[model samples]
Target: MTDPARSTVDLFAPDVAAEPYPVYRELRDAGPVVYLEKLGAYALTRYVDVRSALRDWETFGSAEGTAFNPAMNQNVQGVILTAEPPEHGALRSALLERLRLSSVRELAAWIQESADAMVVPLVDKGEFDVVTELARPFPAKIVGELIGLPPELTERFVLGSDAVFAAMGPMNARTEQALGVIADVLTTIGGITAADLAPGSMGEALYRAAERGEIPPEHVVKLLWNYAGPAFDTTIHAISNLIWALARDPAQFDVLREDPDLVPNAVDEGLRYEPTIQIWGRFCRTDVSFDGVVLPGGSRVAVLFGAANRDERHYPEPDRFDVGRNARDHLAFGYGMHRCTGASLAHLEIASVVRALTTRVRGLELGETRRHLNHTVRGFERLEVRLS
Candidate 1:
């Protein structure tokens, strides 16, 4: 019998947002769904509940926007994420056809190449801000170009990407500043053309889809948000922390250097242990029953993905960062219909970087790093790393 009114599980609470694991454990252990009056949202503390809500999109409508932002109604125009099926399926399919895993494999070498070129010089320097130098710029520029964005427009990509990702968080100074920048960025992408999309890339394909009426035209710009947004921020966050992860324990670094093939598993385990994207939101379209509690219609449900990844019920001693953890089914990339479309791409990108660092960079250690200030994302603002 736990009270939800004064519960520590409210993510909007400043302290909880900064550090939520203790609260997550409390909610998960006490019950399946915790009714939170303050967040005006329900908390899904268990893995099963989170999985079900993601799958049950019809019941958990994305049209109204997932977060508590009532303004998201006007703000979410044309983004495939806000559109329900037929339209959602069409837009998702069109974008998927472009960024499919098969397409990702085609760029694996390119990904490795990019990582090597960027990481080598930095590793040689022995120290650099992992966020500004590597994590932020590298992905912002590289992915922006690969997706058919021109070089001159890289600044828009960088600024907008920050805005959209930060917008995922609750209202705050960081989130406020980012929202204005993202609106402009989306407008720029929205103005681009299929011809300008740089033939055959995901961005170009999305415009083509819009023209073919495969997906809504408004959704095209959002595709940038959906595809590049997840791909860029999450990977950068993981890479930055990954250095933190391995460098924190030299034994682990030694293990990775000894065997390069473990890159994929190692990356997956890192995702599970310290996922960059901590929480994703969904809204109950109608009354939904789970854990013997009924989440009435219009309830805001905050799925504590960070908590689920560390759930001792699903994973043994989830706190430990064992590279061998069987995290295949982990919800780090989410689950069901909305599972991250860029999953393969992210893995390939991260794995390549991971392999390159272990093989090429001899010694690596953390110089300094700061957690990104945001309402949603939990990653580096600046990660200074020293490597030989």
Candidate 2:
């Protein structure tokens, strides 16, 4: 038997965030559950353990703050991200009816336009801050246009998204800052009318669904808030992440350069390699035992997406960055009832830019990278790159 005194959260010490895989491997080998005193919860580290819990909401609840340890964060409530059951189903249906793959397809023209505007300007500069000038601004505009906001609102969406992601942690300084940003974003976004929204994007579609009595118009309040704030951070981070992967290893870059068709595979592999959102939490409604470890009822459990993606049991040679690794089953997007509703739209957007970059740029080099730290979407503050 293992030592009952030593715990596992130490493996997540500040420096450990810089490289979390070793800790994850140790935890997986130790057992399915590890009690983290700092975060005050049990953690599920292995593939089978986590997948089982995530799929069974009756046991692992979301309505009680999916990312906050119930033992720590006492104010957890049911947002669309945390709610389970008939409640989650209704809200999610309202969201997906508007965010369907068909609607995603319809937005292609707008996505193409937004992407083109960002790329064309830097083609000649040869050296530009990819995150600020490209990734940050590009998704900001895409989200703004979709929501039917004035130019000023889009500007806030950029800053507000930064804050919202940062606030998804302990009620620290980041939480305070994110709360202010979220308030401003909600005020700005909630002011939106049918006239303000674009005719065919997800934001506008939600308003339409409301008119049909699918969802009360007031619900559109959080709906649009989610559209701009939550979506932007993840997508922007993904963009910078993909570029980072290529810059780190030219063999991978060369692979994409040689065969543009490999861009999608490369993008998925990049997500698996460096998931910007490292960890998420859920509440356990009942005491459960797995692999001989027991977690008490109402305990919190954090599922480290980045660590789990790198789990050697599910992925062989997990450290290798192959553009053609066939990452079809990757969990970068959470699985089960809460699987990302925007999966299709996100795929199209990432795929489009990857294909475009592969076709156009002969050489892409990074000059400097700035990381914007958030509790959740921790990624680029600014990434400078030169394309030739």
Candidate 3:
């Protein structure tokens, strides 16, 4: 009905990506759908609008690709995040067979064991870099082993995963560099054979599915990329962010340490407070109206998860980080059918670290921290912490 509110916000700018909440709050306050002049896309910043868009896939479609740049969008075409309807469902089903809650729950013991192995020594040492020591290695090891990838390839996948998210933004020098990394990573993955994968691993299972005609033979590589890319990147940042949150407020850590039951609550709150994936792209298949704002057909939409998660209209004291808060409904994982398939495993991995930390570490002190700047995700590249 009315012209959509407009802003010249450059979300992918280094400064903005490092500290985006202020910009996010401004956008959320502007309107339900704010037209981003610089990005040439509409931003859905309110909790209600974002959730609705995610649920209504027909209108806010992912099929045309969800990346801001055309190159990245074209690259994601057949991947689960970009496929529509039947194809999307088929791919999701294959992924769910392994990622189902029941199957993920079975890995809880192994996850906790892995967490303990990683966290305990760091605690005993008094101080460590959370990113390098815990966050990066924990998921790289766990997910890599599960996927049957060689230990060396697992580390390389992390680089590719970061590059994938970085290249999701408008093409620029940063994106160009990321695209180069992605090309090399894809080339490496392309050379792998079934014999290279561990027997009974999820990667091997995908090959078997292709053999059975459950998924296309060619889809195997794309599927592996889909699984490997998001699997480690999101969880790595989440682990670091959660630890950063606790270190920032020792009182919350104490609260968590006292009631181990709140470990799940802490994970949800951490995701809600500092989501790993800050924003994701979508293409409007048709003119979509949110409240009074209209996004014309063919419009590019940026769903601001970070802003919506902290919408004051949705949560009391939205900016405060409370370990007791129940934020399971947060859009950090996205909503509806496209909700992250690895959510359960991510929860398990984050909770494992939280449980391990709360049980052994008495206090946390955050030291020097450097933010990891990517086009879509927010996290610390380096986080120093002292545990006592």
- The candidate that wins on TM-score is 3
Which 10 successive residues of model 1 have the least lDDT summed?
1-10
Candidate number that wins on TM-score, 1 or 2: 1
Model 1 misplaced stretches (Cα beyond 4 Å): 1-15, 172-174, 194-196, 207-225
Q: On residues 1-388, what C-alpha lDDT tens digit does candidate 3 reach at each position? A: 8778999989888888888899999999898889999999999999999999999999888888888888888888778998888888888888888898999999999999999998878887899999999999999998999899999999889999999999998989888899889999999998888888999999999888889887778878999998898888899999999999999999999998889999999999999999999989998888878887788888999999999999998999999999998899999999998999999999999999999999998988988999988888889889999887
Clashes of each: 2, 5, 0
Compare candidates 1 and 3 on lDDT and give the better one. Answer: 3
lDDT score for residue 318 of model 2: 84
* Reference-based lDDT, residue 233, model 2: 73
lDDT of each: 0.73, 0.72, 0.91
* TM-scores, each model vs. reference: 0.90, 0.90, 0.98
Candidate 3 whole-model C-alpha lDDT, 0 to 1: 0.91
2 or 3: which has the higher TM-score? Answer: 3
